[model samples]
Target chain A: DQQVKQNSPSLSVQEGRISILNCDYTNSMFDYFLWYKKYPAEGPTFLISISSIKDKNEDGRFTVFLNKSAKHLSLHIVPSQPGDSAVYFCAAYPNYGGVTNKLIFGTGTLLAVQP
Target chain B: AAGVIQSPRHLIKEKRETATLKCYPIPRHDTVYWYQQGPGQDPQFLISFYEKMQSDKGSIPDRFSAQQFSDYHSELNMSSLELGDSALYFCASSSLGGGRSDTQYFGPGTRLTVL
Candidate 1:
């Protein structure tokens, strides 16, 4: 089963604008969420994350908001740059077990920032 | 200051053969995990090893096994490989054992092709 889902397979936004990528999870046990950005032929790099205790977390140009009631989370990038164009993956971890933190990832959304 | 390192960047194996992929976690990290990414799909967790012990196994088949050594390096072994095993295998390391709060650093990935 796909516990984490990124409904949008691809997204496009203009440079200097805001880009919002959405993710939804069906599992209620998950308490931590993360977003990773990956470039072609390279490993995925961590971008930002939000804990279950907090509704939102911000890191410079990137902000992640979580809504536990809806089981939804989003990553917002302000002033999107061409360099930000890549595949974005949303992952979640369950709180109880040792393996929960291993990360269950979404299908990924390809983002394209137009110059 | 090195990130996760994976060996045999590319491997081509025939059906019924075995393939071994290796990973070296960054210095001082205690947790290591393996993931497989297929075409047009998200990274799927295979297994996790912590402190030279098996922590968790995902949806992978029994043919897949992993081992962790005293030096914190890990190896993934696939026995009797099938054609469906063609994908990119990634190794990641984290400082913490559980929860999504800790970020994982990944290697460039090993592209495995089973003929």
Candidate 2:
């Protein structure tokens, strides 16, 4: 069972525009959510993250919004640049039992930025 | 800014053989996690260690085992590997010190092909 789901397999946006990638989850026990950007033959790079306690978190051009009631989250990149084109993955962290838990990841969404 | 390092970026193994993958976490980071990503699929959690002790377990097969050493590096040992085991294995690390403790940074990943 996929606890985290990225419904969109791919997304395209023109440069200097906004790009939005969505993710959904079935588990409420997840207390932390993160977004990672990956390129071909490279590892996923840490982007932005939001804790369950907060509804949103932002870092530079990247912003992540979380809706706990809906069990959904979205990563938004404003004025998207061509360099931002890559595979974006949404991961959920279960923070129960006072110890670190494994991350559950979504299938990922390929983001393409057109120059 | 040293990142996580994974050795033997690519490996080809025959069925029924054994393979060992290694991971070197960032300095001062005490936790490590392992994940496997099969073709066209999301990453699946394998196992994790905190401060040289096994802290959590996931969907890792019985044929696989892993451990962390005193220096904070980790290894995943796979025995009697099967063809289905071909995948991209990633190692991620995070610190409990401060500032987004739950966030994880991933390595370039080891691509394992079982023939």
Task: Highest DockQ: give the candidate number.
Answer: 1
TM-score of chain A of 1: 0.96
lDDT of 1 by residue, A7-112 (tens): 9999999999999999999999899898999998788998999999999999999999999999999999998999999999999888775446479899899999
Question: Estimated TM-score per prediction?
Answer: 0.96, 0.96
Q: What CA root-mean-square deviation does each model show from the true structure?
A: 1.2, 1.6
Docking class of 1: medium
Best by lDDT: 2
Q: What pairs collide in candidate 1? A: none
Give per-residue CA lDDT, model 2, range B24-82, as digits (tens): 99999999999999998988989988889888899999999999999999999999999
Model 2, position B66: C-alpha lDDT score: 97
